[model samples]
Target: MIRSASQGMREGRPLSSSQAPLNVVGEEAQSRPGSGQPAGTTQLLLLVSLAHLISHVYILALPPLFPFLRDRLQVGFVELGLALTVFNVVSAVAQAPIGFLVDRIGARRVLAAGLGLGGLALLSIGLVGTYPWLLFGAALTGLANAAFHPADYALLSAGIPKTQLGRAFSLHTFAGYLGTAIAPAVLIGLALLGGPGLALGVVGLAGVLLVGLILPMRVPAAQDGADARRRPAGSPTAAGGSIVTPAIVSLTVFFTLLSFSTGAIQNFSVAALVGGYGITLAQANAVLTAFLMLSAFGVLVGGFLADRTRRHGDVAAVAFALTALLTLLVAVADLGPVVLMAVMGAAGFLSGVIAPSRDMMVQAAAPPGGSGRVFGIVSTGFNIGGALGPLLFGWILDHEAPRWVFGAAVGFMVLTVVVALRDRWLAQRNSGAGTRGG
Candidate 1:
């Protein structure tokens, strides 16, 4: 039996039911033990993770295809870069609105539409003969890309048990990273075997198939009416109130700085090592690969830690502080190649360790029933940082300051720690005030 929000509030617990018709039965079943409920939950997790994975694969597919596209279209690097810029810009600009839509309409509908449209757009790119057509296709993909975060997070928050939410988030993030990790190899191998056009068509077909798989699974809708009716008179989401609180805004900035730090390392570390440390390209790339692999492992570790602790902001603060110190060490140290690789790997691990905790903080701070919009608004920080990091770090490289890449990374990490600690303090203060009032 699915309990309404009013019932749950009277009972002093928020039940795991949603406003969407399809989700009520599924969520209720998942909340109880027996009848293979665990297996059902696992299936739900896999489905959500797959959605996350596909979104990232589409996001990354274009980068590998860029080389082939440039050759086929006879375009310069600048024009190719513009195509990427347009994609990210469109995604960033559209994400918050899509998030709002996710709250209003339904996450499942938006997510299914995004996958289908993105796949079709990628197929269009493969078929188009002109540069303008390529740009058009990329823009469509971006608009589609904007749907994933809001929809995915909202669904997970509604469907998954609170105890397992951290792990669910970890798995979702890992799938995204895996998608990005595989995209280069998958796209390039396909292009090599059967031309870029055929490669793109294959990937696009896969996305369309994914949409077919997802459509039958119903998603939960926002619980605004239930929450509004049950909430205290002066609460944030009551009486036509705003969901964008100070904690949320702070979290948004925190995400931006975190992305900025990671973006610097991901985009420039190899070039910086080659230019500044005189490491060979292969050696630098090897170090980078190790960092990435270990970082993924760290996310797994972080998930375990998140479930054991409620102080998510503290977890993020400590991880990022250590990450900053490690990154600074990388900037200043002139160690042997092996030692440098070890240090970089450690830094990567610390950064990854923050991921689950970072997400949990946002989950903690979100106004009740507003996960989609909050995540959507905060995630734009990623696009903002992603857009800005390349420009800033590229400038550093252009000025022949390769060592400054790590310097800049460390700077961003410090800023991230500050914001995270502040968020923690705010959460703590709010909790205390509530305690006293009670």
Candidate 2:
């Protein structure tokens, strides 16, 4: 009976304590004063969002600096690309281990250290006299970058009230996108004013300062010693044990597919529009800008929907289905430029609307105490998709098959709907089983 209950809970059913079922570890972690409730919630959310912003800024800082590095250091484009590749590869490899550290020593310390490390590494890039040193610095930055998602999501999951989690996730994601949007302008402006080296040094110092600021703030741990002390002697921690599970693995794949679809559009949509749609570069850029801006706003709207509905899968399914339809229409239809822009904007809005609900699905699937590790493992999907999507879409563009780009994205969107529905079905089945047992 106990084994069956544990299995059921893992499948998404809620089990009573008497059932001796698997509990989401650390579900009660936020009950402590100044952790998840009213007094500390606002402060915690702000700090986490700031961290999210900073992480994205750092991720983008190097890219804008690429031209500068090539001109000043006389490095080839391949060498510069290698530097970015090293950063991403190192980050991808290190994220899971860092998540383990977050779970063990707490997110507060890890987050602070990551900020400091990334900042110092960026500073090193500014001061380095040789190309090898630049590569080394990039590797360090990647190592630092790996800490954000796992730590940020873990802390937010443990510290925010369940009722407000959707908004928190939306804000966090919005902050990241904001950071990405601003990085180019900020870096270029600083470079023009003070030289590239000086700009890099200043930005790096800012990161260090943020570390100092965050060090003093408390973030709730996924599992704390105090909470452990309060539990019955033999009772399991919520979602304790190994972080790897079938459900988590499925979510990981889901994220990878989602990223794959979006990454193509983000990286190549302007080029695709210019090449295939007979649009000027400026016009393409304008449409892309509208898409991104509307998407961000859509995330805010999605937050409200996430809070109002418990059917996260339904929300995701509907949104993605719409996105797929719009994207397919863009591929097949010979619409006017304005109509194309409107269709793309609508697609972006639908895609954005899925953001908060997608996050809620992950939260529901996460084992309480294991959030850090679980998120760490799952988020690698983004890295994988980021690494691969460009190659795939770039091939389509290189072959003059630009229309296929949107079509490919549509295919991925359809796959995402399938995954979302599968997850929803499992959750519903588990809920029904728990009801019957009760």
Most lDDT-accurate candidate: 1
Q: What is the TM-score of each candidate against the true structure?
A: 0.92, 0.88
Model 2: residues with Cα > 4 Å off, grouped in runs:
1-36, 221-240
Error in Å for residue 338 of model 2: 2.4
Sequence-dependent TM-score of model 2? 0.88
Each model's Cα RMSD: 3.0, 5.8
Error of 1 at 82 (Å): 0.3
Q: Candidate 1 residues 146-259, lDDT tens each?
A: 999988887777666667778888888888888877888999999989778877888888899999877777444242234334455666654547777788789889989988
Model 1 misplacement above 4 A: 1-6, 9-39, 221-239
